[model samples]
Target chain A: MTEHTVKSFDDELTHLSNTISRMGGLAEAQLAGALQALANRDSDLAVRIAASDAQVDVLEQDVQHFTVRLLALRQPVAADLRHIVAALKIASELERIADYAANVAKRSLVLNQQPAVKPVGAVINLGRLVQTILKDIMDAYVEQDVAKAIGVWNRDEEVDDLYTGLFRELITYMMEDPRTITACTHLMFMAKNIERIGDHATNIAETLHFLVVGTPLKGARPKGPSVEAQ
Target chain B: MTEHTVKSFDDELTHLSNTISRMGGLAEAQLAGALQALANRDSDLAVRIAASDAQVDVLEQDVQHFTVRLLALRQPVAADLRHIVAALKIASELERIADYAANVAKRSLVLNQQPAVKPVGAVINLGRLVQTILKDIMDAYVEQDVAKAIGVWNRDEEVDDLYTGLFRELITYMMEDPRTITACTHLMFMAKNIERIGDHATNIAETLHFLVVGTPLKGARPKGPSVEAQ
Candidate 1:
C-alpha cells in the first residue's frame, strides 16, 4: 500500500478501535446504571438502561462497517486480520454484556417495586467481582496487557464461588418462603447474567492470549467454571 | 473473474458451509451427550462428552483455516464476504457451545461419584431446549431461513424459563440442605452453561438475520429470566 493509503487505513483503524472503546465505556456505564437501579430501586434508571442499549447497538453497526471497510481496503493479513476479528468479537461481547446489564436493569424495575426478598449479599459481591473483571479485561484489550488478561481469567473463580453461594441462598429463599420466588427469580437471573459476563471477560482474556502467544494458555483450557452452577 | 474461478469459489463456499454444518452436527451431539450423562448419571458418557469436545476444537481450527484461505484466494466482496464472515461466527459459537457441553460434562464428573441430590428434570429440560435451538440455528444458517432463525431467537425464552426454574429448585434444595451445596452447585453451572448455549444459539439466529437481510433483527433481546435463576 502507498503511504497515503497506509495513513488512511491507519487512521480509520485507530478511529474504529477508539469507537469500540467508547462503546465499551458506554457499556460499562450501562452495567453500573443497571446495578445502581437495583440497589437504589430506581425504575427510571432501569428504563434508561433499556433505552440506552440502542447506543451500543449503533456503535456495533458502526464498528462492523469500519471493520469491513478496513478489510476491503486494508486487506489486513495475519495479525491484522486477527485484530479486526478480535475487535468484532469484542464488540459482540460488549454489546451482549450491555444487553445483560439492561436485563438486570429491567429485572430491577420489577424487583424494586416488590420487597427485598433476601439480603442479596452474595449477589452484590458477585456483581462487584464481575465489574472488576470486566474493567480489567477491557483494560487488557486496550493496553494489550497479557498479564492483566491472565488476572481477569483468574478472577472468574471468585465469581464462581459467589455465584454458587448466591444460588444456594436463592434456593433457600424460595424453599423457605415461596412468596419470595418471583423476586428471587429476577435476582437469580441477575446473578446468572453477571456470571456470564465474567465468562465473556474470560473469553476476552483467551482472545488476548491467542493474539499474543498464538496458542491458548496451557492447563487453562476454557473449562466451565469448576463450581457447580445449578 | 473467470468462470473457472467463479465455479471453484462457489465450490469452496459450499464446502465451507458443509464443513460448518458437520461441525454443528458434532457439537449438537456433544451437547446431547452431556445432557445424557446428566440424566442417566453415566460417568462414562460424561467422559465421552469431555473427549468429544476435541473434535469441535479441531473443526473450529479447520473452519478458520478454510475461511482465511478463501478470503485470501477469492477476496470475496459484498454479500459473499458477509457469508464468509457469518460462517466464521457460526463456527465460533458452535465451538463455544461444544465447550459448554464439555463444561457440563466436566461438572458431571465432579458430581459423578456424589449421591444424586435432586432429580435432573430442570437441568435435562434446559439441555434439551438448548440442543433444539442449536440445531435450528444451524438449519437457519444452512438454509438461510430467516423465519426459522427468528424462531430460534424466540425459543431462547423457553431456555431462559428452564434455567430460572432450575436455579430456584436448586436454591430450594440448598436452603433446605446445605450439605448438597457442592454437588448442586456443579449441577447449576451445568444448567447455566446450557442456558448460555441457548444464548449462543440466539447469536447464530442474529447472524443469520444479518446475513439474510443485511441488518440485525429487532426484539428477541437477551435477558435474565425475570422469575428467578436459583
Candidate 2:
C-alpha cells in the first residue's frame, strides 16, 4: 500500500493494456491483409499473414504471464481483480481472433488455386464489419466504456444477419454451379470465421461490461435469425 | 498459514472441480441427446436439448464467480494458480462446446421439419467421434494427465479428416439432387458444429497441458487435409 507499490501496480496495468492494444493492432492488420489477399488472390500475402500469427501467440503468453503475476502478487480486489481477469480473458479472445484471421488467410491460400468465386465482395464486406467491431471492442476495453462495449455487443447481430444472407447466397451458388462448390465452400468457411470473430468481440464486450459494472450482463445475447431453412 | 485455512482452500478446490465435473456431465448429455435427436429425427428431443443450454450458461457463470473469488482471496501462486486459471479457461471451452451441441440440436429441429437426408448417419458418426474426444479431454483435465490430454489433442485430426470427407459427400449430394439441398445444407452446418466441438476439446487439452507443465504445448497442432478441393 505504499506509494511505490501503488505506482508499480499501476505501471503493470498500463503495460498489460498497451500489450493488448499492440496485439489488437496486429490482429486488425492480419484481418485486413487476409481480406486483401482474398480480393487480389495473393497467396504470398496470405502466407505472410499466416506466418505473423506466431507473434500474436507469443504476445498472448506474455499477457498471460503478466496477468497471473499481478493476480498472485498484488491480489487486486473487486474492480481491480475484475480488470485483471478481464485482461486475461480479453487476451485469450484476441489470440483466437488472430487465429481466425490466420484461418482466413490459410483459406485464401487455398482459394487462390481455384477460379475465384463471385461472392468475394460479400466476404470482404463481412470481414470489414467484423474488423470494425473488433476495433470498437478493444477501444471499449482500453477506455472501460460500458456503453461503447454494449454498442459493439449489439452490432454482432448485424454480422450474424449478414452471415445468414451470405450463407444462403453461397449455398445457392454451390447448388447452381457444381464447379464453384469448392471455392464457395472455402469462402463459406472464411465468412463463418469472420462471423466468429464478431462473436469473440462480443464476448470481450461482455467481459468489459462485467469489469466496469460489478454484475454480469443480464439477459440472453441477441441472436439473429438462424441460417437453417424452414 | 493455518491448518483451517489450508483445509478450507483444499475444500474450495474440490468444490470447484466437482462443479466443473457436473457441468461437463451436462454438456456431454446435451451433445449425446442432440445426436440422438438427429439420428431419430426427434424434434421434441432436439428442442429440449436446445432449451437445456441455459443450464450450462448458468454453470459457466458460477465457475467464473468462484474462480475470481479464489484468485482474490487465496491468491494462489505457482501450480495452484495455474490450476485455477486452467479451470477458468476450461469452463469457457466447455460452455462453448455445449453451445455447439445446442446449435446442432437446433439444426436437428430444422432437419426434422424437412425430409431426412440420407447422410444423417454419417453426421451421427461424426458427432459421436467428437463427443468421445470431448469426454476424453474432460477426463484429462480432471486427472491432470498431460499424456492423456495430448492423446486427445492428436485425435482431433481424426475429426477433421471425417469432416473433410463428409463435407465432400454432402456437397456431392446437394449437387446431384437439388431436392436434397435444403436438408443437406443443414446437415453440413451440424457437421461443422461437431468439428468445431472437437477443436474446443483440443483447446482444453492444450490448457491442461499448460497447467500440468509450466509451458504451453509446443509445435503446430496437427491438422488434417484441407477441405478445399485440389
Model 1 scores a TM of: 0.80
* Residue ranges of candidate 2 with Cα displaced over 4 Å: A217-220, A224-230, B145-147, B213-220, B224-230
- Model 1 scores a C-alpha lDDT of 0.78
DockQ of 2: 0.38
Tens digits of per-residue lDDT, candidate 1, A1-230, equal: 68998888778767867987888798889888887877778889988887898899989888876776676656688777777767877887888788778778877877877788654556777877788788888888889889898888887777777787787788676657656665765677688888878877787788887776666766654445353432
- Please tell me the TM-score of chain A for candidate 1: 0.93
- Global lDDT of each model? 0.78, 0.85
Per-residue lDDT of candidate 1, residues B1-230 (tens digit): 89998899999989989998998899899988888888888889888888888899998889877876676566788789988888888898888889888889878887877888764677887787788788888878888999999998988777887677777788687657756655766676677788878888888899889888988899648564352322
- lDDT winner: 2
Candidate 2 lDDT tens digits, A53-159: 88999999899878877877887887788778888888888898898888899989878888877899999999989989988987887788999998998897888
Clashes of each: 15, 0
